[model samples]
Target: MVLISLVTGASSGLGRVLAELLCEKGHRVYVIARRKNLLEELKKQCKNLEGEVIIIPGDLSDGNFRKKLISQILKKEKKIDYLFNNAGFGRAILFEKQNKKEIENMFKVNVIAYEHLAALVLSSMKKSNNGRIINIGSVVAFTPLPYFTAYNSTKSAVYGFNRSLIYELKGLKVTSTVVLPARMKTGFAEKAYDCYKEKGRNMCIEKFNKIAESPYVVAKNIIKNMNKGKEIITPTLRAKMWYSTRYFGFVVDFVMKYILGPKERKHLEQAVLKEDYKNS
Candidate 1:
């Protein structure tokens, strides 16, 4: 039986690697993202693989597009054997400074689209009573750092969503897994840096760069355990540690306040700007 799969955010970073790996595993993979060119390039690169890469480029945030995409896929492929919901982005800004539309789009893409696509894909998975739902979440979901206000909450919602989904999937071979990963070297970081630049949050991106993990390694490890039947996967040691922090909210809050508070931002601003009048 050929495994049919849908992988979101497959244009770059972890999603790209996951799509490639799924192809390498001889699974017929449908790669989805907003970037059509990159998806085409991925298709070309994986054309010779055992399985195939079917590029479906569109915005996941659009409900109509999502329903149509799945309808189109199920029309041709029969049934979806797996759902990899890895499409999400984060921004660095305080809650008060965050744009209303930006935050709304963030939730629309990160949380709303995730569940929407899952529901669409799960319909097919249920027919076979066999499939997997893999969600890409962040370690920040547990840590809750100050600058990542909206992004953090979305991840928390993902964790809860996955847990509830697991309970509902009981007695079935299908499983729901949420992978929590820490800092990774990907376009995600570049976009996050740009978000900070626009908002004047000049905390050097270098700090994250120093500790960022390789998306290739992270993606490989995640796929390695795809059938291990774990409800949650912390792909790296750092991410595992961060997951543990969820139990200690008070400690996390204290550390976050100390690390990215106004005082720390002001101090970093002076070093980067050299002439801060009175923003703090």
Candidate 2:
């Protein structure tokens, strides 16, 4: 039987890698992303794969788009075997210095879209008695990072949602797995920095880029864990460390702060100072 997978944010990064891997493994993938051109490119690259690629380009933050995406999928496919809620982005900035619209967009894409899409697909999955919902989260969800308050909070929501969903689907074959990945060497950091710059400000991402892992490697680990029947997937050593130390709030916070490096440290200091001055 051919498996059907739906991967959101499949234009780039881990999402794109995951989609490609799925296609290579003979699973038909329905991918969604804002970059239509990149989606086309991905489709072309995977044309000769064992499986196939179906593109649905749209903004995840748009409720109508989400609905239409589901509708289109249901119209074409009978049941979705895998749901990869990998569509999200973050901006590195102090909470007080963040853009309201951007923050809202983060919540919509990271939290709301994941939940809404899961809900829309759950009934079909439950009725079919088979499906895996993979929610792409971040280590920041477990260990909070100072300048990424909004992004971290949204990921925390994803973690909670997936965990609770596991219990909710008790006794069912439908599994909810939350993937908490560490920094990945993908377009993610660049996009986040660009978004922050668009807000007319500078933010530091040098440290993150330094320790980021390969998106292809991350995607491979995620699939490995999925096959292992794991509910919580922390593929990297760094990601596993964050998961293991999740409860050590003070230690994690201190380590996270220092991990920012000097450049980001100075950027944070300046951002906080500016915010304090404005408040005063």
Candidate 3:
């Protein structure tokens, strides 16, 4: 069966890689992002794939843009088999240090937009009777990070949303899978470090360098699990272990206080100071 898949944040990172893999597997893939040039580049590179590829460049955070995108997709394909809500952005700053605009942007992109897009595509998915909704969550959602308060919170919301939505659609053909990934060696960490540097603060870039995994690897794992119809997929072994350990109340509390707490506090202080400098 030829499945029609829609992937948001397909300009780069795991979304782009997943789009390519799905295309190679003979699934019609639609790539959406705000970067037109990058989307075109992806289309060009994916020409060798067996399936069809369509590019729609727009900000998912904009409700009008999402509505337009859905309309366009319906006009072309008439239905969607999969919806991948993968677009997200984050800043490594304390919650108090984050401005109202930044907080709103995070909520808009990570929570509201994803919900709206899923709703928009859900009817068609239900009609297809074998639909999948893959939401890209993070390990931070299970274990909150100090400096990444808003990002972690948003991901937690995604996780909760996926859980509830899956229950609500229990009798339906639609399946919602939430993927929790660890720190990926994508533009995400680099951009956060760059923002810190731009504010004249020296962030511990080496920490990210040590633990971050490749985007391609993460993307591959996500696709592998999605094919198996997993309800919650943790891409890396480390992520799986961490989340598993976190489920134990005493172990999680101990680790949070002794292992991750100090480093997180230090990083958050630096990040908050840097953000303050930028605002000044």
RMSD (CA, Å), candidate 3 to true, equals 3.1
- C-alpha lDDT of candidate 1 relative to the true structure: 0.83
lDDT (CA) per prediction = 0.83, 0.84, 0.82
What TM-score would you give candidate 1 relative to the actual structure? Answer: 0.90
lDDT of 2 at 113: 98
Total clashing pairs for each candidate:
0, 0, 0
Ranking by TM-score: 1, 2, 3
Cα lDDT tens digits, model 3, 10-39, are: 988889899999888888899998899998
Model 1 residue 241 CA deviation in Å: 1.4
How do these models rank on lDDT, best leading?
A: 2, 1, 3
Q: What is the per-residue lDDT of model 1 for residues 147-264, given as tens digits with 9 covering 90 to 100?
A: 6788889999998899899998998888899999998988885665432343554345655566799999899989999887689999998888988997898988888787656653
In terms of lDDT, which candidate is strongest?
A: 2
Any runs in candidate 2 off by more than 4 Å, and if so which? 194-203, 256-263, 268-280
- Runs of candidate 3 exceeding 4 Å displacement: 194-203, 268-280
